[model samples]
Target: MRTLNVSISDIEYNKFGLKGEQLTFTDFVDMVSKELTRQKLNKCLQLADKYSLSKITMEEITNEVKAVRQDAKNRN
Candidate 1:
């Protein structure tokens, strides 16, 4: 594995120390990535919920749009 040497603030170092020896940089990065993904997903869900679109599946949305386009073509 490649090693990276970057400077971190004293506060950041102390905060990481609180995680103890069991937590390696890889573990920390994995944990942070998961947390960031979760937060982004939650924000997307919140926006969808606000728009009353949370109840609809992605497939349903795709189908609905396709149906509308087909209907428009049929009218023309």
Candidate 2:
């Protein structure tokens, strides 16, 4: 494990809406990861709205997953 001094601007801090609060290394990492995920999700939302993206149900996916697992088991 290691630690290093890093700097962040107030604008970037406010962009994440997390200011003037105590945060550990893991907390900072979690915050950054969630922010990145949120940005990617927003882009996906934009594309979905533009093209009217299709969605799949859990039951539909479950059958595919079962088939894949069975195939892998047969391979073993």
Candidate 3:
């Protein structure tokens, strides 16, 4: 097992609502992972909107995905 150290100002820590809270390393890692995933998803959504892909319907997306999968399976 290893230990990690982090420093946060009192004001900033409380501002982020972490004051008096206890979090294990695992919890910290999970929080960081979730935040990263959220950021990536938001970026992808922004890109989709920028490229006008946001107008695509769910059924169209699903069919396109299925077609690609079937094509790949046939190649194998």
Models 1 onward score TM values of 0.51, 0.56, 0.75
Output the number of the TM-score-best candidate: 3
Per-residue accuracy of model 2 over 27-72 as CA lDDT, tens digit each: 8899889989999999988886787553646786798899999999
In the range 10-54, model 1's lDDT, one tens digit per residue, is 786685454553456878798678768988999999999999988
Report lDDT per candidate.
0.79, 0.81, 0.84
Model 2 residue 35 lDDT?
Answer: 89
Report the error of model 3 at residue 1, Å: 6.0
Error of 2 at 3 (Å): 3.2
Q: 27, model 1: CA deviation in Å?
A: 0.5
User: How many residue pairs clash (N, CA or C atoms closer than 3 angstroms) in each of the candidate models, in the order given?
Assistant: 0, 0, 0
The superposed Cα distance between candidate 3 and the true structure at residue 30, in angstroms, equals: 1.1
What is the total number of backbone clashes in candidate 3? 0
